[model samples]
Target: MRGLSVGLAGLAALGWAASALAQDVRPNVLVVLVDDAAFMDFGAYGGEARTPVIDALAARGALFVQHRTTPLCAPSRAMLLTGLDAHQAGVATIPEVIPPEHVGQPGYTLALEPGVMTMASRLQAVGYQTVMAGKWHLGSGPGDLPDAHGFERSFALDASGADNWEQKTYMPFYATAPWFEDGQPASLPDDFYSSEFLVDQLMDYLGETPGADRPFFAYLAFQAIHIPIQVDPAYTDRYVETYAEGWDVLRGQRRDRAAALGFIPEAAPLAPTPDRLRPWASLTADQRDLYTRSMAVNAGMLEAMDHHLGRLVDYLQAAGALENTVILVTSDNGPEPSHPVGEPGFRLWMALHDIEWRTETLGERGTTAFIGPEWAFAAASPFDLFKFYASDGGLRVPLIAAGPGIASGIRIDSPTSVADIAPTVMQLAGAEGAVADFTGRSLAEALSGGAPAVYGADDVIGFEVSGNAALIRGEWKLVRNLDPWGDGRWRLFNIALDPGETTDRSQSDPEMFTEMRAAYALWAADVGVLEMPDGYSVHRQISINALQRQLAQYGLLPGVFALVLLGGLGLGGYWLVRRMRRRRHP
Candidate 1:
């Protein structure tokens, strides 16, 4: 027994030495991505959600207060992995939102171009074991799966989002969940929840070939708090009365909290409530009840996701890999604004498919729910609009990075975009040379010792989605928010001083606005941004895209059958008329 114990101790020491050596070479990268979470949804960012795991991570890492992602998911995900502008990455906008005229345009291909290398590919080139789980909306089909892009093992959902608890597509744009495992069609385990299932799959991948001496890059994307915001009943119960006061009050509360936390200037002006949103006081009791429950479900989803994230962190700690791993937590975009469950097309489709949105099942297995524009507006807090617009609310999101070399308990106020993530991760993995030439700057300097700025005063950064556009040069930002959100007017603001974008300095600073506009035009031309058709509306474009898909899938078959049936009826009628005429003549 004594001899066996001595042998075990020697083996343990050898294992420790191996792990230490691996840490010295390259830190393991753990990217925790959440879908459609608002800027202040997590407790770490000052919202009411209980996210102890994420908060703890913020405490140990740099919290980027002004970080921005594209206003939607796919484009942001593309930028995050490729370290390039969304247009340069070939996903200028989501497929469902792309107009037919713009479908095959240079930057509107709706998928990452084949030659574009991903962060995973860059890291894997340098001996890292790259693995990914959860959402992979960059592309679809066998050739587009994560394995093809450099992940050695991947369990990916190639759609925007799907049902959290069931293996089914949540939106009509997808016919199925489109889940895949290492480039092959895969099935979900019987017991599944997006957050838990993603973490478990990543852990499984990490455990395979355990003795191999290689660092890892794990991208764990969660479909939490997206549409169909379901969570365990226990989690939902905790926030039952949390949002009883409604979005109006919640918006003010969150705005104040953000100012207090220095996320916004102390005197930052609140953006006016969008004209489309109905006043909370005008809602019926049932409407208020349903909306309130939906908000609770949203919060519950975040808390549940955080809890599962903690489980993964705990596992890493148990394996003695936590200290050597760099973990980043962020959202793909801002709060979702579309209320699909209430759309005319959605209701018709649900009726045809025999699905219903029962209040009792609001956040349960078979029902769908969302926070609507009102709550989404509040969720974005002091920012101007929700998802699908270029307002700070839609683009600015939380970015937390913690691990071996990152500075602790600090807030990095420098402007950072999702495009910077790939280069930053490559730097941390010590695979800088492996990465392709990209536009984003590395955040290494800012992460360790504070850098005054990541971009030079003359360097221009531009963003565009659907039709909304914004360009930032030094302290000035020139923006255009299309229809419903704005009057389709060009505006300007010194974002450095007025982050909420309440005051437009266009009239007051014509010279700066003119310069910024020219810069945006130049950037657009360089990136091959296509012109939006006149009267292009994102909401209308989505409906048209859905119609196109339906026609492509089912319209042709039914239309052909109808034509054949009508032809037969016409022939019979002609024969009857001829026979009747002959009888009359005889």
Candidate 2:
């Protein structure tokens, strides 16, 4: 007995040393990504949205007060998955992202380098299953897709933005061409809302995927509440009668309610809704009813999503995987404004920050949307601009992490970036040789209620709206306007107290302003996003010893069906594209 105890201690110490040296091991990681949502939409973050499911998560885990994602989806996603800044990966702008052909060569465009250890590969190496469902906007091609990079099982749409749920619709602006499901395209019509469809597919995959008995990495990127704005009849009914007055009335009410509920700061004034919208009283009765109904639908979807999330939690809890799984919930970018409420066009202008995005028309865009800035503004609190704006209002998002080893209900102020999620999950998983070329840090210490500061970032963050630039460092943030009729100049704010960014302190602090500007430029050139599929490689294979298998099998190889499923997807994709094109043009 004494000899056995000594041997076990030695083996444990050796394992610890090996893990320390291996550097990329972690627990079963689950990243729940919300689309185009700002930091304060949920009940946990003190917003009006009935996110009881997420609120439960917040109550059970640590919430990040100062968390941020890049302003757009593709670059932000790249940052998260690759653990590098947009500059380092070279995918700065959504449209400006370098093509796959332009990637991976020495001294060329930034793309997901094939050699780097992705979260999937790292987890796979340690015998964990890697599965991704929902949006895979980074790329759509063979190399660019999740399976090519490292994910063992995937069910995702490769396009960047879509609010429509009806499948197989064409999205030309997404850079990936059209989004698809499985190997074939889903025929999402004008009314086929993405939020509902995404949930359906995700639920299907979770219940049936491989390594269900093994430690797994589940990356669920939901398409809820993005564009082609949708509201199921159930949720739409709740607000059809209530929100007849348009955004001003709704914003006023939400602000009052939020402030009263202690969700908002006391002294901060409610930023008025934009001039582009019609007053509720002015719109016709049908228009008013549509607005209210639309809101109801949106809210209903939120509730439905919450219910489904509860289902997932119930599954984990029932399986006893609840204690072992570390769940992370966050958003892709800020709340995006799309279509006309009662208004005629997309209201991309800012209320106060003056960081207005150029007005665009969905007439040229692919889908239809009913609601406008009213719904988005109602969702985004304390922030100034819509999704594409570079300000904190456009970039800030809530990050909730809960599970065993996590301190519950704690608020962390460390400068955590979305890019940190991959490395953080790797650290949590205890997988060895997980990630390299990572520009982010693990929040493990902080999540566990320790205050070890996140390193490397010297208090600087960058954002871009087309060519417009915004930079945040310390308490101050700078926004450069791109509106030609205006100054096209820099405006700065102290974000700590002025979270809404109502006041500009740039004129007051010239030296500080200069420092921020220099920092912004330097960081922009120094860091970037890596577009995946550019020779990106995450070569992790599981060790039977690392898994908690249901059977006594020492080495569990993936079934042939799994191989055929992933292997045939790319070729099948090309065939589908050909078929669609033939049908369309011929």
Candidate 3:
């Protein structure tokens, strides 16, 4: 027994030595994930929000103008981390928007399945310390938290979103914030703000192994700019009058700015505004004020997040780790479009929770604020639509990478997918063996000024979530978005010429369109893409899911109320029958 113990100690010491050697040669990686930020929502990308830190990051690194992700958050996250399609990563759709018919069917399980490896896991296997802080809407099942997925330390929120100031659910989809630290339930601090707390937690984790030569992979997923877009009044004050021109004018302004910034073609026609949006001049004065305040709040929330990010960067620089760290900043998807205040039963739910929706306190604590679809369209700018669809407006977002071995002040316009992120990180970390196992190709060469682009013109990539689908082949894109915003028919566009998707080339280029459709069909089958049910609408599905979750959370009280109402109705009918019979006899 003594001999065995000695052998174990010797092995442990050798393992430590290997890890130390690996750390000495490799650089640290920091991934900053913003929630529901649009393609042009950063100051570097010509957005109204003042994001100086991110803008600086862009100035010093490669900015990808044609990068796209899955149209929803969880799926984009899964793909971003795994280098796989959303289905392959085991999160085809989020719980809030998934239909009942699709539950528990293979990739629709909504959790990372067995044998799937995240970037954290891959990096950890190579002796890198992995830590994560912020929203982790991945899964809550056993072995599904960040700890099980190779994060050495994690403070994760396992819900779509929650109040920024308190430990409460943002919508009826969840009962609580559902925060966890290292897989154990946790609570927020007394003076909690989402962005500040998330950064603080990450800094704490990074400090745990201070001066230790072990390379670290830090994932900071901010909940900023998502629904319930709350920020300090100080930040909100900066944008109060910025969006007063309203969405229509804002949309045109953004499109023009995008062209000026070289993000799109100079003559790219603007996509038509969504029909559901009312003309800004036609709205009541009160309505305009409310909406303007809400947009201001959204911008403020993003700026606040950027401010906190600057803090983390400063911390790393002060710790002498910034010089060797590779930083990647991006959003999960396009801007959020849902307005909980207008959703059925949401007002009552807010009332029960003492939440306010007044314009006077739009971005303050205890108030729920959102930009809704009109602002979402403007935020997306030169693109066709926003989140929950396959439109570029939903999928195309900002991606900036700066660090060792990356080119400075370069913009790569070659189409790139979120799945490419994991492989790129792996290559940068010198973990090349695992890159082959992933479906995504590495962009390390492009970032390092070696290659012009990552994907060749002939390469095909596909995306699908909740029935919305798109196929990208070189410069041409074939997309089919579900109803309410789209006709469910496939349309072809030369995205290189019209990034705004202003013209449909399906009729003009029949042969290419048919070929791309066939390619998409093959890709979908290869990726285990499930067919959505007839007339499947993401909005309707969300409503259905919310009702189901609400019933599950507070079923007993509602059930009792329903029974009492039925009982009272039965009694009233009996009384009426007796009175009528008595009158007839008399």
Candidate 4:
């Protein structure tokens, strides 16, 4: 009896200590980010972009087709890091001015604001070794740098975004332009892809993982598929020939697939934006060749990256941490608005972008602008409009969660958002999700097939980029220009029914529009939407001046060429295998 008592007492004591320790131990989290791709682009979601590794994972995990996020790159990454919407972060617009003030308010800026909690800081507080490798678009100055925040080790762009995705970056945000590693002035080959370097470092880091017993939190943001897109020439031939169809044929095909998948009620009739194209017939074969190569380079980069993702998973499985570690793969945003900038990639292009009415594609002479609506509509998938707009097609992203507790091959219809990612991640790690509560809920139940729903009916979601805004409340969504110039431009859509915001019901149901607008006002007050500057904030000459200085610094001749170059695609990240990228049929 005495021995039994001692044994029981010891076991009970150990249990108590473990319970306390578990609270202090944060799970090793791996948040994988895919740049610029959409949910429909994946095999899991039912579209045709090939990502086998991600698909295999999804076959045994949960996929959120309705996951919403900002359609632009920097803002989306910022939102993902902080779990706060854009306004609170003070990153409403992609600044033509990389103001020094926007750097970390402390060392960890939650959208350039104080008191905001980052996933890194939150995980770090509970004993996580937060590490960020690749795109850290939140802010990158003194305290705002990844190191200043919770990330103990950091390898990312120098500022809110990167300069060049290829071996070089023209932007100051990089350690010193032309790409540097971990803030060190390192020299890389001109052809060395930033993504390859990022993945090499990530694998090197994962390669160092001693065991499943010691957990890590890794944020792998790969800046691929973003503009100046480049890839290993080995796979160049495959895509170069594929993209030769030019703009019109490609857009038509994308529409057909989107409709077949039921993402769109019916693919809206193809409406090419005039003054926006080089009419396929008008362009000589040589012109077509160059244009086609520009896009092929971008697509090939995605394909190559997808293959690398397969290898990364192979490494994980070989290391014996495959099933235990949690993996969530998603994109920062969907396809960018194919709107032409003056140049293929430059800052001056952005100033021209604010012109509001001049929708020109890049490659023109003085008037040369962006690629415009034709390509934007094709790539955005089942929705109208691309980056910077408050539309479903613009915000809806692909989300996949696989590992221990999550079920495979599931399509979760719940309207989740990027904010939900952190909580879902924390919950599945089997750790106490007790700290730094957020606007998101644990989707573990849904991922595991134990629960039918994820969040609640009242779970509201909002996204903003450069003043364009959108808010989701249940089935109805309101995408309006908020308060002041607040035309309420009231666009109401049953997102559940029309994931594509093509059919406008504002006129059909004025009452619903008003209700949604009112609801937005109330919600904005709660979340605190930043007050917009009254009157027309865009000044072409002044905007051009600010942009001019930025261009000169980057070695570009100012004006339209800069805009086109800057029109690069939505930036992507590195978080998971290839399967999470596929889109679905309706």
lDDT values, one for every candidate = 0.81, 0.59, 0.85, 0.57
- Ranked candidates (lDDT, high to low): 3, 1, 2, 4
lDDT of 1 by residue, 205-310 (tens): 7766652478888899999988878887688778878898899999999999999998878987898886667778988888888888889899999998998898
Question: Which candidate comes out best when scored by lDDT?
Answer: 3
Candidate 3 structure quality by residue, lDDT tens digits, 1-586:
3323323333333333234345587888999999999999999999999999999999999999999999999999999989999998889999988888889988889998888899999999887889999999888899999999999999999998889999998986788999999999999977888998888788777766442568889999999988889998888888879999899999999999999988888988989876666678887888888899889899999998998898878777655667688999999999887756665455567888999988889889899999988889988999989998999999999999999989999999898999999999999999988544887889999998889878888899889998899999899999999876888999999998988888999999999999998999999999999998887876656655665665677787874442332222255633443344334320
Query: In model 1, which residue pairs have backbone atoms overlapping below 3 Å?
Result: none
Flag regions of model 1 displaced more than 4 Å.
1-24, 352-354, 555-586
Write model 2 residue lDDT over 524-554, tens digit each, in one string: 5565422234332111011111121212222
TM-score of 1: 0.90
Number of clashes in every candidate structure?
A: 0, 52, 0, 67
lDDT of 4 by residue, 284-383 (tens): 7776765665555556566666776665565555444465567888888776544223322323433443321121222111221222344555566566
The total number of steric clashes, by the backbone 3 Å criterion, in model 2 comes to: 52
For candidate 2, the 10 contiguous residues with the lowest summed lDDT are 537-546
lDDT of 1 at 482: 86
Model 1 residue 544 CA deviation in Å: 1.9
Better of 1 and 2 by lDDT: 1
After the best TM-score superposition of candidate 1, give how far the Cα of residue 396 lies from its true spot, in angstroms: 0.5
